[model samples]
Target chain A: MIPASFDYIAVKTVPEAVAELAKHGDESKLLAGGHSLIPLMKLRLSTPSFVVDIGRVKDLNYIRRTDGHIAFGALTTHHDIEFSDLVKEQLPLLASAASQIGDPQVRNRGTMGGAAAHADPSGDYPTCLLTLDAEFDVVGPNGRRVIKASDFFVGTFTSALQPDEVLTEIRVPAPPAGTRGTYLKFSRRSQDWAIVAVAAQATVKDRKFQEIRIGLTSMGGTPLRASAVEAALRGKSADADTIRKAAEKAAEGTDPPQDLNGSPDYRRHLATVLTRRALEQLTAGR
Target chain B: MRHRVAMTINGTQYEHEVEPRTLLVYYIREQAGLTGTHIGCDTSSCGACTVEMDGHSVKSCTVFAVQADGAQITTIEGLAVGSQLHPLQQAFWDEHGLQCGYCTPGMIMAAKQLLERNPKPTEQEIRLGIEGNLCRCTGYQNIVKAIETAARTMAAQAGKEVKAPAAVS
Candidate 1:
């Protein structure tokens, strides 16, 4: 699976990486953990003339507490995120999902920024990020800017990022304490991509729904929020009947594509079943 | 274009000017001539090309040699010292852990990491730990036994070190 011949530049700093991208223009690809880009290159799905390796950018591998969020360095590996105590304490939904992506080796080499920027519809982080309301930091010759998770994902294998831009950070706003969140991925094999996945977060105040967010993966071109379901559950009593009703509409507006995993209708059913299960689990932990 | 990639494999440093697309598994096998690390699947699925890179197990096929330019890698070939097999290797032989042996290197490497993290991993943990490595011949019963044996053996060694007689005090 040798990829097409390409030039590789190991960039030591974010500025250097941006400069390389600027130099190569659209021919350049910012290589982070290389788990996503290299596989694409090997399959001939992606062919870039210049691959600026940002794995050597030391400053871009951090997990820190920012003003009102936990900022994950763009190049933070899945293994790090899964094991980081801060992530476990602050965002267990994301940490648990990170633990389920591919295998230990893949998790050791895959980066959050690469996964989000690649925007694989079945990818793990996008679902968690979409539900968690994450923000992506992009830097380029023009300047640095932040893109909300909702607006960042444009379509299948596409993002709002320009070719010359580098995604430098992923900032997840800290959810309130005592929030119950869980990620449910139904896959055929341990390392297989999710056939249908769901991430749910809820905050219960006096046994009533204080906040509710649901994110679905592999349901469409982009990670889709069960907006109707969320609307139904928000501000409602944390009751089984309400959750079941909201989760019944899980597949209402999704356009899932069928692959070898299952049929579209089967996935939709799984989405409904898993959504109910996820909501139940979220509320049960309260 | 080729880039100069120098890495430490099994305590030996090797330098090569490999193409940007050259995978680390090929570099270790062809350039370094350490064929113990097998390449069963070039797509990084089988985990036959697993190797310890900078203290973490990684699928060598997916990692470009240039990406591992300065990393310290450990392959199956490095598991034995002076004809004495590593505990995991010995346990595999004792427990009949392999059938075709194609996935041994990767299985052991993955097991090494698992045991390192959880020395006394339960059977379920052992199965979950080596889920990345696939062995077609063995249904993982014996493989689980081998890891358990190795974990116990390693724990005994650690215990001996901790319980060493205090200087005749």
Candidate 2:
């Protein structure tokens, strides 16, 4: 499959990339990792006239902690985060999820920010970001603004990012001292996208859940928070029966899309099953 | 849409004006005249087009040539010196890691990255490391055997190198 011809422009700075995007408008697409964008281009699903290569932008590929949050530069690849000691020790959910994404070659090129911005409902990073309570920093001609992960993802293959704005960084709140997190993805192959996924996080004190958060992927048009299940689990003790009962509501309020991967009913069932596993594992492991 | 690009491939510098949409696999094969890198699925799903870019293995079909401007690239053609095959290649040959030989180049490139990061990988680790490269022949048992053999040979060679340099100087 041959992609339509396009002008390629590489920029070293965020402002320069933003200017290029503004000049080309929607005809231009920012190239980072190129995992999601290039495949779409090859299939003619997306035909941007100009490709602004922001992959080389300086100081935009790092993972560090600041102000009680882990701020990852937008260019940080899945491989980097998966192997990062900071992510391994602190955000195990992120490390685990990044490690499971699309094999080694894909992880080497795929960026966490790129995946989040692509906003694929079945994608791995969006749900992780949603569960982690991430904030996206976007820069434009006017200035820079931070958009919360919940508000940034608007629909399938869409986000709140304007055509002229460049996503510069991602900020995620650090889990509490005793909190642990886990992600469960049920993709058919190691390199394939998830049919249904669950990301569970909690801090148990004396077996009682001090804080609980669960996010579901591929159950709808966007990665969604399992709010009903989360509400039911909050303040509850971490036990097999309690977790199973709470996970029953994991698919509430979600309209799962019917596709070749799974039926809506089947996806709902997966959500319930995976949520139970995720919660049980998170509580039992550490 | 032709864009000027310059880069080092296999320790040699090359410059050309290529279309912005030209995939890196095509650039290496057509523009640079290196046919060792094979193209299986142009959609980035197949790893037959894999190559090492600046020390990381990537699917070249997914990367536009212009996007790789100013970066150093290593395709399968650059893996050996003279008539000497890379350790992985020799190991693959000895271990019968293929039936059709279509995925060998990409598989070796992927295994090179794996060994570079982890010189002595276990069998399970080698299998996990090459998950990106798909061999249609379904001869994964032999491929894993070849990688494990290569890792052992490479480690021994590295040990000899460490000893030889110190002895000579």
Candidate 3:
């Protein structure tokens, strides 16, 4: 499937990319790994007149530690994140999710920032980033600004990013010590999109849930926080019964879409089951 | 608009003026005239168009030809040196890894990467490694065996111990 003819602009630096976007305005689309955008373009779902290729921007491909966060350059591929020792140690939840995304070839070309900016409700990074409360640094014609994960995702296939802005870096705050996390994705196939997935990060102290955050994928138009479940579990005993009871609230505010993969009710049930499973696994030996 | 794209395919340099939307798979078959890489599914789901771009496996169909500027690409046609077949090709032939031979190039390319990353992979590892490449025939039993055989052959060529397939029943 060939995408519509568009003028291609390859930029070597962030400034150059920003300049091109400013020139083209909304008529341009930034190409990071091209995994998400190319497919949509081929299907004519998106037809940007100009494509700014930022895949070669060397400065925007890194994973480094900052003050209290692990900052990832927007161009860091899922393959890089899945195998990064820093990501594996600091953010196992993100690592696990990245490893499970698409397949080997897809992961080799898909980027973290691309996934987040695409804002697919079933995307793995957004769910994990939302649960981790990650922050994004974006550069535009005006200037640089930071957006929180909570506010970055506006809706399905939408983000808060302006047409002329490029996501430069993703900063995931280092979880407090003793925190354990897991991402449980229940897909029909290993490479398929999640039917309903759960991302959980928990910290237990004295057999009590000190800190618990849950993020649900494909449970709503956007990746949503299981706030009701988190609230129910916070400061509560980290027992199997308590966890199960709290997980029942996983779909409290979600507006899960129905398709051939499952119905809204089926997704709700999966959210609860997967949330419980994730919590149980995270708090197993705590 | 057309874009000037230059890349080294296999061991030869090829340059072409392609549309910005030209997929790498088509560019390889038409521009470079290497038809060994088959296109099973235009979508990224199928690995039939798999190729090694700069030492990593990627679905050529998903990658634009212009995006491969200055990249070093290895296609299935590049696997054989003159009349001698690559270890993967020989292994597939000996193990009957393919039936209709449509998915052979892609499966061999994917397996080449798997063996490069891991010289000796278990049955489960082999299965997981080639998960991207689907074969409707052979039930993947022989494909797994073929990869194991290639791994051993390659390892033995490097003077490493040819361990038996421990996970295969």
Candidate 4:
């Protein structure tokens, strides 16, 4: 109820949405799902003169296969992704992550692109995207640009998206054959945000770790890679001791913030515990 | 500014001009005059304002009237047919699913959605389905039992009656 008076324009096409965003610039906000934006607007935390609703753009709500990746449209609801056969088959990690997002209602109305673009530090999708090395396909008045997942997130409630750009698609590479991935989240309740979450992916070859990627959420200003752990994991034997020692380094270089749910120390502890759990789950071979 | 919205509620179609910021809960209670969908927490935490919007249960207080402009909505009042209560409503009444009756409607609506998706959910699944809905009075024990009983009744009505545990005769 605290939302101020704003122009409401529901566009039918992606180009129409992009053009409207181009015209309005900083004064307008593109609304898809509105799970994140509307709540902020209701709190009077953000005020936009125009709200260009892109939720009705059906073309931007699809899951298709691309060259080596799954092309997910920006407006694809979390519910859709959670129940998508293609996503489940191609990227079960994403499907599992999607299933654990908020609750049923929030999942029904929240969008993957919206969460990724919003880049909230504690959101679940950013961690998964970071581990998957996802690419965001953004469209603006100029054209389209594919931004790497690591570069897409800048800071709290911020992204690399330009002011006039609309995130059109999210392309997540299907994990390589024999690669395993898992997302581990710790929260007090089903609906609460993750206090700490970890997305760990690795490929094993000849009983040694061939490649490894680790993504952490709610541990820093942005979804971050466990670079120290990733470095320590390479060339190590796929054994419990090695993985545990590597995961212990998961909290390294992460200046986790303290909040009511947990202190920085607790979150750091959670990162270590969850990273170990995630790595153990992944090495268990799906 | 007020915009005209057309929607179907409980099998009746109505059109009205409403303020853009008017929440669906307000439009339902004030304009359509259906007060069964109670607004407990306007911040989208408590599902006491839960209603079926286009076949999906959503917290009405969190949704704008304009967002549901052309949708179909079903409230607690719509759950009964003539003089017969919905099986879930009857089960809740029979199983003591209410203490003050404030959270009953939302709990029933959310349980309906769960049963629709999964007709025979386990107790754990039922708990997960209604996690967004909070009921401080019932301690959640009787509420879960009521939902379980309703699911059985609904299944029986659908000709999928589950056999009760057999005695060691």
Off by over 4 Å in 1: B160-169
A1-286 per-residue lDDT for model 1 (tens digits): 9999999999888888888898899888888888989889999998999989989898888899999899999989998998888888888899889989999889888999999999989998988998999999999898899899989989988999998899999999998998877899999889889999999888888878899888999999899999989999889988899989999999989999988889999989999999999888877856
The CAPRI class of candidate 4 is acceptable
lDDT of 4 by residue, A223-242 (tens): 99999999998988888999
Q: What's the TM-score of chain B for every model shown?
A: 0.93, 0.92, 0.93, 0.93
TM-score of chain A of each: 0.98, 0.98, 0.98, 0.96
lDDT of 3 by residue, B1-169 (tens): 7889999999899998999989999999999999999999788887999999998899999998989999999999898989999999999999989898888888999888778777788898888788888876755888889999998889989785654432110
Ten residues in sequence with the least summed lDDT for candidate 2 chain A = A277-286
Alpha carbon lDDT at B103, candidate 2: 95
lDDT of 3: 0.91
Model 2: per-residue lDDT, tens digit, A57-124? 88999998999999999989999988887898788889989989998889889998899889998999
Q: After aligning candidate 2 to the native by TM-score, how far in Å is the CA of A279 from where it should be?
A: 1.2
Please state the error at residue B37 of candidate 2 in Å.
0.5
lDDT of 3 by residue, A101-152 (tens): 9988888899999999999999999999999999999998888999999999
Where does candidate 4 chain B have its weakest 10-residue lDDT segment?
Answer: B160-169
lDDT scores in order:
0.90, 0.90, 0.91, 0.86
Task: Return the clash pairs for model 1, or none.
Answer: none
Model 4 pairs whose backbones collide? none
Q: Pick the winner on lDDT between candidates 1 and 4.
A: 1
TM-score of model number 3: 0.96
Q: How far off is residue B27 in model 1, in Å? A: 0.2
CAPRI docking class of candidate 1: acceptable
Ranking by DockQ: 2, 3, 1, 4
